[model samples]
Target: MTHPELVIRKAVWKGEEVDLLVADGKILDVIPSSDTMYEGAEVVAAKGLLLMPSMTDVHTHLREPGFEYKEDIASGLKAAVHGGFSNIMCMANTDPVNDNAVVTDEMLRKAKAAYPEGGPRLFPIGALTKGLEGKELAPMHEMAEAGCAAFSNDGLPVKNSELFRRAMEYGSDTGKPIIDHCEDPYLAPAVGVNEGEVSSVLGLAGQPDVAEAAQVARDLLMAEYLDMHIHLAHISCRKSVDLIAWAKKRGVKVTAETCPHYLLLTEDALNGYSSDTKVNPPLRTADDVDALLAGIKDGTIDMFATDHAPHAAHEKEVEFMHAPCGISGLDSALSLTWSLVASGKITFDDFIRMWTTAPCETFDLPLNSFKKGDPADFFLFDPSEEWVLDATTMHSKGKNTPFRGQTLKGRVISHFLSGKKIV
Candidate 1:
């Protein structure tokens, strides 16, 4: 018998039926009800819901310090918690650009200060190049000492391969990851939409698939050469997925992530040239979509990330080619991922790994699982409940979401962060 602070009976963990007991923000015990007894604790009946380890988004843009018009740290984090995330990593592309130790430190300070009453943990990433200009490397050691969670040059790829290799070497020495936005500017010059029949029909400039694959190839080779950890962000092209799979099989020290948009939407989404579907490493063909989802199933893709880029109304409300690239994905990422699993495309256990375990491992966060002594960072969701996204009422300050009006299967009934209810 154990006297826990709270007990959730009939929780589904790792797809198995179990009772979860929690105390002081950590799981205390899990036992078969027939062999267990609770003395005094608050009970939550979780018969139909899945008790998943807290979700983590390794790719998200908070748009703070300068782009408050789009989103701020507080608003972005609030949206994340409501969406059942317990930990999230913010990208380094910001106002001052989190390239220097000072800017990186400020990002971390503001993120810490913006913690909601009960919300997901925020981890700030530092830039790899000074100002992310790719002309010169930033002070990697200094930013690492300042508590940056990782090093990245997201949103912009380092065009200079030599400089990128130098950054990788520095990152390896410092034990920091180089998260790259892999898109070769040369192969996909002046393109807007994905290179495909859809783009051809719409008369839009095509962003060839080689753009993404070329960068992934270069970075993976660099990572292997340097013996450094490299993480590719928002992979979209079919060849990009195949390249990662090939590198992983060859034992390269590489890891990568793809966004929900890539898995769920295709270049067909860009046929109308709606800015909402516009994203960096722009959405690709249906073949690319199939490959992305296959990568998730086969473990080639490390995890699912939102790549939750947000933009102001004016920035995205204009005509097709003129609109900025991005989509707000934090809230809709998980539900859509779950739907993919529920439809038998992927197993539930595998889905959990992508959303929970894999992400924490990628970012070097504490191993979060539904086990005793682990933090009570969890999301309780009725997997059967239907949900329709509504950006007007979302917690995010930015209202640009591509999944608006889309129906999803699961709903987060409640979320517990540090043993306290948040949603």
Candidate 2:
């Protein structure tokens, strides 16, 4: 055989020491580093670095087509690469929104054209309703034809039960799942944080846990009746997880995700109404965080996503309720997650499975592994490294991160996409 174009020596492949060979955008083979040498290949040493499948975030908000002040396709893709993400599925919450085929196709073309440097593959989700109005369904078939991977109305939940059911039915034929931001607007109007002692102490409006569970219950029943797969985004409450787990036990085809902040932080972060700590489904108490971690370990919570929402400085620099409901997470998720895993709160393999394999399986993408002939997508991580996060040094356009100056573990030194390097 011809000499491989790239050779990564002394790396751990699925936890075993081996040399990985790549050519023409695919892994050609994995052999003992000391046993083989390609005379003409560009060899790189990977000793003591973890070689695992790259992350695939199923919930990301690029804020393109209008909100360039927050983020654009180019900047978002760059952040994805720096964060060690090889595949990203974006929500349909753009300016005009991704409700039509034209918007979907344009976003696809923009992402493909902007990232010649081998960033994460873009999988755009189309809107479920026109303008995400929660009244009329968009052209589901047409948008799917334009190559959307799924359908969603993130940043705004579909409040109309009848309209959502119709969208779910029409969306079933597209072979893609419908993702819902399950929150009942009526119950949580103008709410700034989780309805509890924290919101009461702060003298701010609160959103009850029932607000989220109500919508989750409605959506689950809808999915069961329609025989469709439904994905819940950024589930924070313990009740929501319990419901989903119970539903799964009864054999409902449903899956859910929680962001790193929700799994790590709690309402204590919002004690003084600092806008940075605020987020949708609002951070819960320490008990809630404990529940989320347990749910993750036990297979009730299927995956972990960044929910990497970004906003401009001015947008988030206002009073609590007037400020935006998200923070930039792409660059922080892995390191924070690794901290818990390293402390034996969760296994390292569990971390890999959630950030890599589970999301791909849920989205119907090919499962990522280190086997030969698979796409050469993986991250070279120094699991023991420690670093303090600095938002100004981040590659993401949005500088609104909550973990500023906090020490985190497990940094990605390099990322590979196909046969080329992205970081």
Candidate 3:
């Protein structure tokens, strides 16, 4: 079937109105809107909408193969597109755990079936430890061959330093970075909140910043010794940022990412004992938030990831201490990040680079630019659109979000991937 030429008219590109012509699954041209003439093409009037390359998330949890109640490949991808993301890398923390080539192949097959004609491509991260048990190393070589984008033991950190080193060394050979969920279980066993005044007032067990910083410190040293690429996932504490900055100065092959919650919200969000605020590497103090912002400014933090963990509503409705540590983020990542941009904390270009360019560079994925011959992957965003985040309106099955009733500015109006409109 020959697809009609897709023409987006009057879209704002770099502060000027432009027309985008997409055909044959590529961007044919980008010309001044006034100079373009529409003929028999499919027209989309995008007046007053901002046009840019869609974003990518390097850390996400699309619970498939074991935990479909929370999220699946199809639902997760739908949520990603709704948030203006064109590519995502899912963590390997499923029921059986994605630890080998078999699981990796199965995920790729399912992803293809979910988006058959190339919509927001899904990349699976194979587990570094078998079953994420932190004992035996997973089949990295075979999984890599089967199309694993990276290796990570995300939900559970590998506590054994020797085992972790071996995994890092092996991962380096695959040319993919070893992403670690930096945490010391011994230091903060089953804790739900950050160790600080808020935790004390709320009477919840606190997971101190040291829990994450210590592990980050260890991983950085290991990366230095082995000279392998290490990417830290969802860093939340100030000390952790300090450690990563110190590592980069020493020329360690390390890159770190911070989630939107860590940058925008703090442990104070848990003031009312809201389980929705409970997240692994629990939210830290305002001081930590400030440090994280500084990290982004100084280039210590490489990218912004949603860490889009989703859980069932029933699971999060119970007592705060027993509730699972996560919140659905795919639907809110862009708006929340836009809040930062609007506040002048980061420039619009910085936000775009972090979400688009930085992630591609970190994962070695194909960079998307709305250039001629480039894949037609972009989104139309309305920065002034204001709306409340209602869980029922979301595409993801898991609606356990802390921002459920919050009003957010900016929203994705339309998205095209591979010259096809998926949202």
Candidate 4:
């Protein structure tokens, strides 16, 4: 059962009209549309569509090995493909946690079976601390040998600086980034919202900006001292952005990422106590949003990730304080990001670089490109398409999104992974 070669005709690629030829799971050629004539190849007329390298999300939670009611690898991969992402790095917060080689091996086996014919590739991040308890280090050497992309105690931050320094020292030898969820438990309340007008007016326990920026500052200093790479996850405060900029200026091996929700939504979204807006490192003031946008524009922020945490409907249907702190993002990340491009906050090329090239470079994943012999992992996108996001239509099992019912511009019309159309 041999598949025919795929030829995209008259597609707009890198601001020019070109024809793309994909065969044997690799891009064979990319030439001007007017110069090519493929009489027998499977032709796809992509006259007005845009062709760009597919996206890669470095932070996502596919609640498998325990929380399948929320999301599994199969359904999560579906959401990734639908969101125009060809690769995703999953967090190790599942039942039994991916702290050892056995769990990493099991996850890889499951992912391979899920995408047997070619879909989004899954990279598992091993736990930085055993059980994510943040007391002792996990078996990093064993997990790395079994295919873990990085080490993180995500969901919860490592509170002990000495323990984190030890982990960074160990990780420097492996050459993988030590990614941490930056938050000081002492500064953050048990049930926390952003410490500001929203929390004050609503009479809820507030998690101040220092809860995140303090940890970020410590991690950056430790990375500089230890001469190791540290990646910050889901930075949401102005102070955190400023700290990252200062660290980069001083030549520290530090990189940071932010989610789309932090850019598009604000504390205003919580006016009615919406549980969907109850993300960890809760949405901040308009000034913080402006700072994050500036960070993106000035290249202070290295990458953009979804932090695609999914939760069961029952888990998110409760009161804001009782509800789990996360929202399903794999289904809406790209669309929300396009809003930035549409508003001129970031250019189209910059969006592609942040979502695709930057993450791949930072995490040592395969660089997605249109070069000959590169895997045909890309998508045809429509920049002018308008559609309302209905959570019911989402491919993920979780319907916990703050963007439900919002009209968004731009969408992935078709996606190809390994030369096969998956959406």
Candidate 5:
């Protein structure tokens, strides 16, 4: 559907207040906020709000095709847009598992059906192994051609090095990054909490930081050996950070991400035995958090991801030991990450680049260029708005967020996709 010529006036973008002109679902031009008037264009006053490209999450689990009760494509896409994200790349951990072209095409079709015109785009990441079994490779090239943005074996490590090598080689051919959830299963058989003083205090099964660091070390070595790019998912420990830094210094093709929970909260949050705090490669110690902050500051860590794994209320309202490992991270992602900037841990530039350009560059996904003829995928953010998070009210079906009761600093007020306002 074609949209009328529209001008968003007085929106703050790139530290300057400018007027954006949109036509035919693309940015027509950006003009200074003068008395200049368009004769017939529909104009929406932005009220001097922060205007920027909508965020992109490279790691999210929408739970579609099989787990609609947890979160379907419609609900997940809605959640992404509400979180000020226009492009989200979902992992291949669905019930049917998006390993083949048919599944990938179907997911894309469903996403388009949900948002026929302006949409929060859904990019599917194909599974590295068939059915995510870590066995033989899936028809990855077929899936990539179908519409997959990247390849991954999330929720499980591709433990077999030989198979992982073939998958990386395949990813190289396809020009997409291979996202890996680094973990040594044998070492961390139980992952209720971080293995340390907290686990000993809570008497829960714990996963040590080394379990993740060990896999990261192995993956880095493999990436260096093969001269292939590997994206490490959810680095929660200092050991992993050190290894990633070593790899980057040696010019290894590696990019890494960490979740908001890891940056702000720690294993101490698990002391209450809340299942929401239970994430795979579980939250690490304060020292690890500091190390992660350092990595983010120095550019060792490439971007931020929600790892937005959603689950049913009953699923998370169980014993900590039995509850699934994940956090429904999309809804409040921007606000929480902005807090890091608010505290001066990372510069505002780093925050913007990580959320917008970094993930797009890392995964080879589409991004808003904010230039003439480019799709106008943008959002209006209120940086000073403080709102208490209510997980049950979030757009995603699952209400399993660790930030459930906390007050966050920033939020999205409106979103425009391809020049049409969606939220």
Candidate 6:
């Protein structure tokens, strides 16, 4: 008999009662649940817990090669594995920016050295424009060769239409999607609050939802015009959803994603005047959240992403207006999304599809097939487990989440990569 390295007994995999055997850091087989056991193998009894494919995040900020103070590749990958993410793509908004091959190489090197014992894999997203300034194009082909999965100008939207069009044209040849932060800089309000009753109540300048929708419309047209792929990042409001739905019907080569914050929280969160609630494409109204949910159900949203933007405490501790925009959400995004499933708002299939297959297919990242020779990257999750969100609970160095102090359900019990438990 072939000797297996490890066996997880009776874990529910895709709703099937199965026994998983791993060998040589790859899945050897998944047999029906049985008492027959493999001798001389490390065994884990995972009855009643979920054995699901680890998640893939298309958007995250590792903040290395510059702002390591907020989060470096090591801390970010650590947080990712703890969050059950086996594959994560980091955005390019560093001090020097990941616009060229050198910065891309630096990000790749840092990721390579992180979690050598088994951790989440990181893919760098090179800058769409030089310095993320929107004025000059970055070296797309060079960065692509340096291991950039995609290119993005996250946190800095390119306002010049012609320049953005030229960047997209250049990006098409890289064989990597150009992910866009869809918010019109000129129309976006300086304040982080969303335009709504809560912002009026707080007396804060509110960013209109049109700021996102207008840019979405622009990018959709650009995708249709250029006949190229452009992925929209962190879409927040209803109008954008409607536009995407229309574009999809018309066969525009566009894909979009919404963060957990937009699906779960509304602008009402800013009533406390906490800087933690502040995020770009700030949380919108219940009506907007409803639209986003509907978009998810109908397949217009394309996929789910955390937009796990982390910020230093000092960077977010100032007055709400002065504080930088972001939420340290890698820790809470999964559980909050699971809450929707637990509440019957979305199905288990929808959850798994959006979290795993959808994003991986969208970005061309590898997805765990749980088949023989497939890398053993998966997790055991306790749906019954409930815990509170706090500084200690988060693995990321930045603890700027608005969900802090809230009790959350569905915790990851064990995270395994390459047939070994890492968290």
The 10-residue segment with the lowest total lDDT in model 2: 364-373
Candidate 6 TM-score, true structure as reference: 0.97
lDDT of 2 by residue, 33-68 (tens): 675767778888999998877888999999998898
Q: Against the hidden reference, what TM-scores do the models get? A: 0.95, 0.96, 0.96, 0.97, 0.96, 0.97
Better of 3 and 5 by lDDT: 3
Write out the backbone clash pairs for model 3.
none
Ten residues in sequence with the least summed lDDT for candidate 1: 31-40
Residues 223-276 of candidate 1: C-alpha lDDT, one tens digit per residue: 788777888887887798888988888889888888888877887877566788
TM-score: model 4 vs. ground truth: 0.97
RMSD of each: 1.8, 1.6, 2.1, 2.1, 2.1, 1.5
For every model in order, what is the number of clashing pairs? 0, 1, 0, 0, 0, 0
Query: Candidate 5's residue-wise lDDT over 1-423, tens digit each?
Result: 234388889988778998888888888778777666777888888876988887899899998888889999999999999899988899888879998998999999999999997598889999999999999898888988898888998887788889999999988898878889898979865374889999999998788888888889989999999999999998889999999999999999999998888999989999789999888879889999999999999999889999999999899899998899989988988888899988999888888788988997777666776877878888888898888889655888878988898888888888998778899
Compared with the true structure, all predictions reach lDDT values of 0.81, 0.84, 0.89, 0.88, 0.87, 0.88
Q: Tell me the TM-score of model 3.
A: 0.96
* Model 5 worst lDDT window (10 residues): 1-10
Q: What is the lDDT of candidate 1?
A: 0.81
Ranking by lDDT: 3, 6, 4, 5, 2, 1
Regions of model 4 farther than 4 Å from truth: 1-4, 189-192
Model 3: per-residue Cα lDDT over 1-423, one tens digit each? 234398899999989999888888788888889645556788899999999788999999999989999999999999999999988899999878999888888988888999887878889999999999999999999999898889999878988898888898899899888999888979875476998899998888899999999999999999999888899999998999999999999999999999999988899999899999999889889999999999998989989999898999889989998899998999999999999999999888888888998899889776667767877889999999999888766888888888988899999999988878888
Candidate 3 lDDT: 0.89
Question: What is the C-alpha lDDT profile of model 4 across 141-244, one tens digit per residue?
Answer: 88888899999999788888899899998887777888988888888643547888988999888898988998899999998898789999998989999999
